[model samples]
Target chain A: ADAAAGRAKAVQCQACHGLDGISKLPDAPNLAGQNEDYLVKALHDFKTGERKNELMSTVVKPLSDADIANLAAFYHSLKP
Target chain B: ADAAAGRAKAVQCQACHGLDGISKLPDAPNLAGQNEDYLVKALHDFKTGERKNELMSTVVKPLSDADIANLAAFYHSLKP
Candidate 1:
């Protein structure tokens, strides 16, 4: 998974999670400098409904594993 | 539960989460201005190990429901 590609694909996430991985919205967690392992697990949980969130579930449903990995890598690369 | 009391109780959380509910550590999420319902639910999840975190699980273990509510109210009162 390319971090650069992830940055490009992360445009959809920018409304709540900032382009730099900081969150702009309430209830949205900042993604910068978070553990990549944790991020990937969270995306999987959201996609599978293990962690239930209306917006997150919908957003993660269409993401492939590579997409999830790339996003996690991109976010993890930023400063917290 | 008093938001004031929650603020007092939140001192223990200040190491990772700031007094204002912003997080200082990577992988530690900011709590300010989050949904009250979501906060309570997250506390419950942590306590039950549904959302597992070594620190959160231990932190929430001793809290009563009222304590959770107070903490939620206190964090929610802040600006994100």
Candidate 2:
């Protein structure tokens, strides 16, 4: 996945998970330095309803596979 | 941070997060090899209502600080 492209696409994620991948909300999990595979799986789960969170399900609905990969890459690239 | 004590205490968590810390439930995130500080913070957040999840709040309400630490330590000890 392209980290640069991922960064550009990650703007939507900035509110809860910061641009730096640290969570701004107490309820949100920080994404910085998280495992890429795990990030990808979580996003997939949210998209598929295998994981259920109202906000996350809505947010991930519009994302494609590449979008998920890019977002995971971008977040995983950051320092924890 | 006693892994052994945490293991005993983690019986309550087994229904969702497996003994190895991999999640059995779709909505539960895998805890194996997760960051210790993040795990501790998450439990604390649940306990204090900084984070809100009905089941988590109920489950963490009775946990002491040491219980949280031991749980984090035990889960973090597992391989992702």
Candidate 3:
């Protein structure tokens, strides 16, 4: 999985999650310095229906395992 | 907006995003250290349809303006 591709993928996430992943919106959580294990679990939870958000599950469902890995790596690569 | 309350709200975001908003998962992101202004814009984008994420919009739509502010503050209060 390419980190660059993951960065590109984050464009869609910029709205609520922001370009850095940490949200500035009220109630929205920041993603900038979160734990990687936590992120993977969350993504997996969304995709696997463990989580209860319809929209998130939809977004994550389409992502391949490789895509998820890349995304995770992209975020983790930054300084927290 | 109460930063402490906002921190509580972020519990759901712990995974993938991590507790501090930096992801440890491969390909995820570090939300702990981003621009506050950027974060605010991202959340607004999601809630307002300026962005194209179904999940994020859904998640952000449920929050009030105050809630967003609090959440943003919580993340911003951290060492990003």
Go through the candidates in order and give each one's C-alpha lDDT. Answer: 0.82, 0.83, 0.67
lDDT by residue for model 2 over A1-80, one digit each (tens)?
87788899889899988998877875577677666776888799789876567898999999999999999889878875
TM-score of each: 0.63, 0.58, 0.52
Tens-place lDDT per residue, model 3, B1-80, is 68898788778657755777655455444556455555676677678775545556777888887777777667667765
Candidate 2 residues B1-80, lDDT tens each? 99889999999999988898877865576777666777898798789886667799999999999999999999878875
TM-score of 1: 0.63
What DockQ results do all the predictions give, each relative to the true complex?
A: 0.22, 0.12, 0.12
Highest-TM-score candidate: 1
Q: Name the regions of candidate 3 deviating beyond 4 angstroms.
A: B1-76
Distance (Å) between predicted and true CA of B16, model 2?
15
Ordering by DockQ: 1, 3, 2
Give the TM-score (0 to 1) of chain B in model 2. Answer: 0.97
Lowest summed-lDDT stretch of 10 residues in model 1 chain A?
A26-35
Top candidate on lDDT is: 2
Please state the error at residue B53 of candidate 1 in Å: 1.3
Return the DockQ of model 3: 0.12
Across residues A31-79, which tens digit of lDDT does each residue of candidate 1 receive? 7766676688889889987777789899999999999999989987887
